[model samples]
Target: MKNRSLRIFLKIALSTMLLTCIRPAPAPLPVILNSPVGETITAADITFSWQAQQPAAGYIIQVASDSNFRKIVVEETVSTASANLHLKTDGRYWWRVRARNESNIWGFWSEAAFFILQRFRVVGALKTQGYPHDLAILGNRLFIADGQAGLAIYDISIPEQPRLQGKYLDSLNVAWGVKARDSLVFLAYGYKELVIINAVRPESLKITGVLEYPQPGYGYALALRDSWVYIAAGAQFIAVDISQPAYPNLRFQYYYPRNCRGIAIENAYACVACEQLGIAVWKLDTFPPRQTETFDTDGNARGVDCRDGFITVADGRNGVIFLQQDQAGHLTELAALELNGYASAVTIEDTLVFVACGSGGVAVVNCADRANPFLIATITSPYAYKVGAIPGTDYFFVLDRDLGIVTVKKEF
Candidate 1:
């Protein structure tokens, strides 16, 4: 009897071991609710829903100002498939849901989402072909200067969509730069010299003034501040006083050995970027001009702009360079960022700087700290040529050589 009992006990033990090895593990609980992500939705005043792997005893809903839920706003336990959440705030909010089994083990939280709340407003965008070099907005209309298309006008009364008003195609060479003040429009035609027209009437724009150059080499860029208008030629900077809109009087022409590509005016000073001459600064009051200060940038300078006490230069080789000028007019290099592609143009508003890169696309940088600038974002296209930003909006307009116009908005 003892031998038989020992043999039966061994067989039972072997059978128990085989059963344990073949059994499968239990499945994980499913995520019930998913958060929404958008720019127009600020609060969570909608229904939150989810799913489950097995039958759940109940679900726990938690809402917080942070993703970690360190500061909890709401904690509720419910058994239904949906819960109504009425948020009273107008900022970013985080929420998640958890399901509990009959054994009381809780599952993991769902993914987090963000939403921005604000008064929505429409923004305008302008683009063109044949190299859109410059843009100027006056009143409610936008003027674009196309390299080979002459002057193109658009009525931006409706910011979201701009309607083409007309195109003044008198100049066949190229419209390099444009400036509008009062009712007059000044255009720099490549070899056609400076052509002025009356832009007061949208239905009809007539040529009112023309300044011919003896030997014109494409007028590349221009800037207008107060009554003075500065134009960049091959190797010369021409200053014209536009106190009289109908007729622009030539003040003086300053010559540089290297070709000038971009020009900008700030208060009583004008900043010019010479391809090989580096950067030259001149006083608007002085006739025939002498350089107040010249910085030796070891790159081909393409665009320049000045604001406050800071000067920004777009160098094709070295990227974008930021320089600070003291009250005594002494210059010091603050920052130099090496962008992969060529930095073609630089424009600043408040603390934000927009750089147009030829192939790398348009880069937005935060210039809050002069010594250390941070690139916030980049808007890329097949061939991004120019970029412009609206003063009070998060919208940025980029002119792409092949993609046409691309409008970018900050989703956060």
Candidate 2:
């Protein structure tokens, strides 16, 4: 009986010691130190701070544009409780933190703290059947270059609510770029070939032509002028003669060192956006197009547009670069507009320059002054992939990777 009592006493004493030794979970929830719970922050640079728990070895901070943390845009782990972040675009964002101990003991995620960036508002949104890569508009019709799903046509007579009129779903064709003129639409496939469609009637569109490329993935971006179709595809600037839409003949192919993204033409000159190679200018009038002048930029040149003697290029990450053609037809760098993220697409409307910054938003720049161009107004979106102006309206279409196409008017 005495031994039994002694053993029971020791067992109780050990249980008490273990209960005391166990450290309470190191601050399972961190208290947000800066910014109000639901305040709008104008500055793009954001700093997140939390209380450092007693035994925390490190802290992880996660921020997302969505509330459910579905897509964590920025995530970082630091020893301290404070972390500075560069949030993309202007919109509502949610953030949360979790703590970890030296022994790799992770604490529960803290309650989410939310904030808003009111730089731009959503005018209109539509969800496409598949990923909308590129689009072209003629009259009130919008032809979308859909990935995997082939071609999709929409009636944008009423820009607010775009009615899907017809679709040609091709499981084999992965469409990349599109250009619409008159009743004809030129579609570029991801792997190869350029398909042409005659859409005189939206209800019944027909495939009228098919152009095959020498390179498998060479049919990416295209610019059509009458019978000549200039392509910025893969690592080559290809000129296809489509005088007869049904029969496309490859006339010229200019291979650059880097991938080509956009192509623009002026008279006999062709300006190609050669990714890292900058803007390559070629004399297309020649039998074998000869590269005349090349303009180097700080960014990855993705798109180019030129008129009269002025040139504008969407230089990825480095923003927009404006160049002017001199009296001798030499290109000279004039001005530029600096943006936060990748400048993916650019369109010129008179003196206004519209730029689509990937996840950075869309900026309207007034380039009336070639020396000093300034932003007019910005349309903020986290997935601003491409921007294009409507043929004759004060409206512009911004394509989002997930949100389909967003229509915005030139308010400013």
Candidate 3:
């Protein structure tokens, strides 16, 4: 009887050990941060979000100034997967999240994610005369379109202090747009004329030639190529022959039902931003360019710039827009990012795009990946009208209607 009892006890102990060895462990939960991850943000208000885990009752989020989370700035526990918070400081930050299971056991903390805020800084700024509308940089000189105050010239050899070198006031009308090269400068004079100036001697700028459009016309913007000047007039798009600056003549003129506000040229293609009509494109290989296609946009198309096969536009309230051009000179929308303020103009420099957002500020975008463009930084202003980038440098200039010329630099 004693041997049988001992045998039963041994069998029961062996069965218990076998069941414990075969049983499986619970699976680990995953917590992943979504947006603002590895991105540079300009706004103070941001939403922190993470993926929801199954069987999770709640989540804990923490933000820190250091990667090791030694200096924790925020720590909160919530039932939801997202939290809206305001960050008052501008710098690099690290964040992590973890979940609590229904059994009251906390999961492992997520791997730390990092991001940057306000990576740009105001390096210099100067007040200017008149309501500055647009700007052009030629070598060391800066030309400004100062509305009815005329055109103002400055020597930006020192970007911090743009000393006034010369200015021309058109008492009759306003200087709406400007473009300059070696010795010549083109001006869109109010609604009736395109004025050519001999800027070789800026202090004594003389109007060398003036092409007057018929009655009731608006000359809003202009673009310069080889020896031709393309004009975006309210209801018309005109191309003028500037081979002879002294006597400019019209080479091609076409009228559109929608108003044309801006113009840009790439290789043999010319694109005009036609307000509500979107974009109007022309093939310029022929003596008289022909309109090939028209594209519609979601917002008011105000300004544009194009290079290689990529096109960028500042769509009024819609912000910055990206486009692609095919071999046939056809254009298609790739992506559109809505930003703060009213986008009035855009300048494309290599992989970067600078947009002038009136009142909202100036936005710098990274377009290295055309299909996935994102904002790098934003420099706020009272009224930003136009933006221009200095070649070979990360420095860009913004023409503010209320504040004049503001210089911004991208910090590493």
Each model's backbone clash number: 2, 0, 0
* After superposition, candidate 3 runs with Cα above 4 Å error: 1-116
lDDT for residue 103 in candidate 1, whole number 0-100: 62
TM-score of each: 0.70, 0.69, 0.75
For model 1, what is the C-alpha lDDT against the true structure? Answer: 0.73
Indicate the worst ten consecutive residues by lDDT in candidate 1.
Answer: 116-125
The models' CA-based lDDT, in order, is 0.73, 0.79, 0.84
TM-score rank, highest first? 3, 1, 2
| lDDT (tens digit, per residue) of candidate 3 on 289-388 | 9888878888999999988888888899888888998988788999999889988899887777789888888877889887888876677889888888
CA lDDT, candidate 2, residue 348: 81
Candidates ranked by lDDT = 3, 2, 1
TM-score winner: 3
Candidate 1 lDDT over residue span 184-220, tens digit each: 8888877755778898786788988777677654577
**Candidate 2 residue-wise lDDT, 184-300, digit = tens:** 888877656578888887789898887776465466778877687878877778878889888878888767776888877888788888888988887776667788788888999
Ten contiguous residues minimizing lDDT sum, candidate 3: 21-30
| Candidate 1 steric clashes | 2
